[model samples]
Target chain A: MRLLHAVWTDMRFQWKHGFYLVYVLVTIIYLIILSFLPNDILSVGLPLVVFSDPSVLGLFFVGGIIMLEKMQGVLSVLVVSPLRTIEYILSKVVSLAFVSVLAAFAITGFSSYGSVSWLLLFLSTVLTSGIFTLCGIMITAGCNTVNQYIIKTVPYMLLFVLPCFSLTGFPYSDLFTVIPSVAALRLMLGAYMGIPLYEAISLVIYLTGMNYLFMRWAIRVFENKIIYQN
Target chain B: MLQIIHLKNDLRQILRDPIMAILMVVPLLLIIAFKLMVLYLVPFIQALIEFDILPYLYYVFVFVVIMCASMLGIVTGFMMIDDRDGKISELMSVTPLGRNGYLINRLLFSSVLSVFYSILGYYVLNVVELPFVTILFVSLLSSNYSIIIGLLIFTFADDKVKGLAFAKAINSLTLFAFTDLLALKWLTVLSWFFPPYWITLVVQTPHTLLVYGLALLVNFGWLFLLIRHYRKK
Candidate 1:
């Protein structure tokens, strides 16, 4: 019940701050522009767009949300409340995941009607959003300002996103599977090209493990850097 | 004298901030990476390409230089937003430095860094066959767009979160500069409203004095409008 209230509160904050509006506008623009491309191109481009919009967008905007809350002294207040750390973190992750799922569906459904698997898309979007949002919280844990957050996260962002670019062309390597985004990308691509049972099982396992690890890290960092420090 | 003092203080602040130090160093590192990519990766990729690689390299060079400037502008915008949140801008407004002096300090800092990065990026990319004066002139003109972006960020964003969002949105829009490589006529016409698009055009067609003039006018006009809006608010 408290988690639901927290999600509602965060959603209201996000809505009031225009994050939702910007997000919807960006999604609409991406869909409109992508609708112009050929189907084969859209097949490749759709996954990349999903990787960027929902996954990376969640990472960045959630980081900003946390930073904003920190600046507004809300985190300090929440730390003293009855709300557990897991509950607080879950609220953010779940709310962002909800938005990410809607966006991923909208983009995929609009662009590729009959070709893609809706179930795989839903799983990939939710898991990837969870991973990136947790990563964002972890990255911004010690940051007092946005500039500092950005500066610190650039290398990490590159570390995460750059590897995903390898999906574009030749020189395919299994090494990329170690990156969480690679797992997410595999799931997204699987939606289009039919997932093998082994690939599906393994990616699901890998992404789940990564999301758990990232969530644990986020909670630990939030406790030490944000809650205790404050 | 006042400008010198403000500049000195701003430089010291940048030096002291670890994030600003990272921002400074990241560009230098990227310049090195760009040089390596041109020397090593470009040749490899060029082998796969059917067309001339020189034009592609030129576009990438312009894109990198302008991107450097844009990143520097974002850094400056973050600094200004930080100051606003910390009430330092308020404090400065009460002093002889005033708000205008504060803004000028930010503008000077961002423009100087933008020009430096632009030149360094050009040198690293090593694709510009133009004369030294032309390269320098283009870099200066390109750097003004960074100033415009910095001021636009300051005017539109009220805090660090809003600043980040605004910076991302602005940078994404400015990336329309890359569309210039497509050479699509209608798209190029639409790209004119974006300042960095003019920079790409100026680099591609250096002989066109009218393009150069328009670049300067658009950037300066936006900078002025943003500043006026900020002051009014």
Candidate 2:
């Protein structure tokens, strides 16, 4: 309860900074511009090529914030505060995740053309990406220096973010629900194609479960040892 | 007792800082990432449909504006942290070196870096629509905005490491946003209000010398303010 309160306050602090709000507003304006393109290209191709996947944008943006704290030793300072590792990670997950989801929803909702089930797709995106973001936290947690973290993460981002566009076009098998972003992509494509919702729901369950377990392991890592140890 | 030599040495110490690497990577990141994207995407689309060169030109304008303006805002934020963390200003204040000397070196380095990044960005667009000599001036103005923003941020850096990290974050955000490419065809209304935003407009139309002129005025205006602030410090 206390940690949740602290997380809420932390979000308030971030909101007061006004940067996130402005960035989202900017993204909204960006999507509105996309709304004007010709239907043929706009519907099929424009979103993929021009907008690409907005999901990646959220992860990269939040990852940059996490990476900054690591770089500036802000995490180190915060670690000594009256909070547990779970508390800290949860704060980021709760605060940054909501804004990121909001950004993704706004972009996809405004631009994408598909069934009314797009809302479900957006929710699946938010949940599915939880694992990836957790993976980001776990992967980035133990780095020695800020530059080292960036070097490590950029390639991973290129690996994930680049291929994501192709996935929307390609048809990976049902087993793809196991791969994190793939599950999210499946949900989006399903919604766009108006495929059945059962698979989407099932994939969402797997994503949510994986995200749950990942957080458990991540907590252990935090409790057992110092992260960002050089 | 940290002298000019120490300042030079400090510069050498964290050259490979993540923030610095991000700063260095950013121009390349925006240009190359978007260009490769276009390269792959254009072929994919064209296979299914016909095309006009306007799409390609639109991309050029998009990237140029997005990269230029973002470079302006983010570099400002990063330099702020750099100057603050390194105890650089205080150390410099104690030395016989003029504030102008320290600031001038920053300008030189940042300008060179900005230009290098801009050239890479320009080349990426060249495969589509390389702006004329006039657009080159616009690129230069965008680069100058970066250098000036660095100076502005330098005066505001809370500390050196913070500066370094802020540099990386700001640079990353700006690159991801890529202001110029946001939306095209009717984009002039929104972007042209900002000076760096005109880089693409000038590149596309070449008639908006006034936009480039205003960008210069804004940059010089900031430069003057930065110098005045440094003197007070």
Per-residue C-alpha lDDT of model 2 across residues A104-135, encoded as one tens digit per residue = 56666667555446566566656655655565
Per residue, candidate 2 scores C-alpha lDDT tens digits across B1-233 of 33446546636754746556465556676777667767786677677676554455554544554465456445544443445445665576566665666566555555655666666666665654544666467557666666655654455544433334344334433323235455454554544444445454555556666755765675566567767887787
**CA-lDDT, candidates in order:** 0.79, 0.56
For all predictions in the order shown, the interface RMSD in Å is: 2.4, 6.9
lDDT of 1: 0.79
Given candidate 2, what's the lDDT at residue B204?
52
Instruction: Judge the docking of candidate 1 as incorrect, acceptable, medium or high.
Output: medium
For residues A1-230, write the lDDT of model 1, one tens digit per residue. 99999999977876676666666766766775686677777878887788777756667777778887888899889978988999999999988888788778877777744578878888888889998888889888878777788777787878877887677656766678889988898888898778897998889889989989998888998899888874
Interface RMSD of 1: 2.4
* The best candidate in terms of DockQ: 1
